[model samples]
Target: MENSSRDYSHINGWGIDADPKNDPTYPMKKRTNEEHRGYSWQRPTQQAETVEVLHSNERPNLTAVFGTTVPPSGLSGMLRRYAFKHTENEYAHWLPLLLADRINVVEGIIEDFKNGKVPNIFAEKGMKADLQHDRAGLIKKAVIGGLLIGGVVAFMAGKNSNKSRKLDY
Candidate 1:
């Protein structure tokens, strides 16, 4: 085996100690088994195809990730929390397929809650003031309506009394 450091090539200001071409001594900086490895930025053809297959499988593995127990509030909180945590895990390629499937389901639940189909705990917290204002407006309208009706009756009664007095006189 030839030593790569033995052959020295000089370029402008840089000292090239190792052979740029074929190195007989140290073959292509072999990756150590303990060296941390990760999924390539672009997945391999087989891995991409495998991910596609896993996505289409539809086994409802979200139940495994999110668990069966509903959160303290309801399904919305449980799903939202799971989505956030799942997103972080997905970045690490831990649950890309499962998380991708679940993200939409959880987001749909959140949207339904927004559309008033489901009770959204997040909205409920902020809507207390709005609900109170609506109730107060309804009460005010009822009170104003009652007062207007009472005033009309009083005016009619007064007119009747004046007419009766003139006729009697």
Candidate 2:
């Protein structure tokens, strides 16, 4: 009669060829694929090796950008913190769009001045006085545009702050 411990099978090429009776850890109870959630049963040796690799804490966190550190918990919190820190510590940077707008207004003012009208404020500061006088309309227009842009930027900034707070995890 064939010994039950000496029975061996290699159904899906798992390489379990050696006699089970010779190994102390072999001839163990095995589970079917459906019983282990579609995973084949592993030998004791292979399972030990896999467990050792999984328990090792040698891998680095992949979420952090260069020169930044991230905690293992809650990724969204870390991102929000990093963004807030970056924006808060950095100096105010001039945006190209805003600079372009200012340049356009200055050019408009120059054109208006060249039309024989300069702002009276220039003369009030003890400057040139032979300037013509139709600059009031141009000055008022520039001031109104500047104020509108500033208000919009302020409103959007406040709205963003509130939204960011609401999204905090």
Q: Which candidate is the best by lDDT?
A: 1
The local distance difference test score of model 1 is 0.52
Native-to-model Cα distance after best TM-score fit, residue 147 in candidate 2, in Å: 0.6
Q: CA lDDT of each candidate?
A: 0.52, 0.48
Residue-level lDDT tens digits of model 1 in 28-57: 356464336753575333321211111212
What TM-score against the true fold does each predicted structure earn?
0.22, 0.22
lDDT of 2 by residue, 79-146 (tens): 33333333332432223324444555565567679998785655554333223444666567668989
Steric clashes per prediction:
0, 0
In candidate 1, position 31 carries an lDDT of 46
* Pairs with backbone N, CA or C atoms under 3 Å apart (clashes), candidate 2: none
Query: Deviation in angstroms for 92 in model 1?
Result: 69
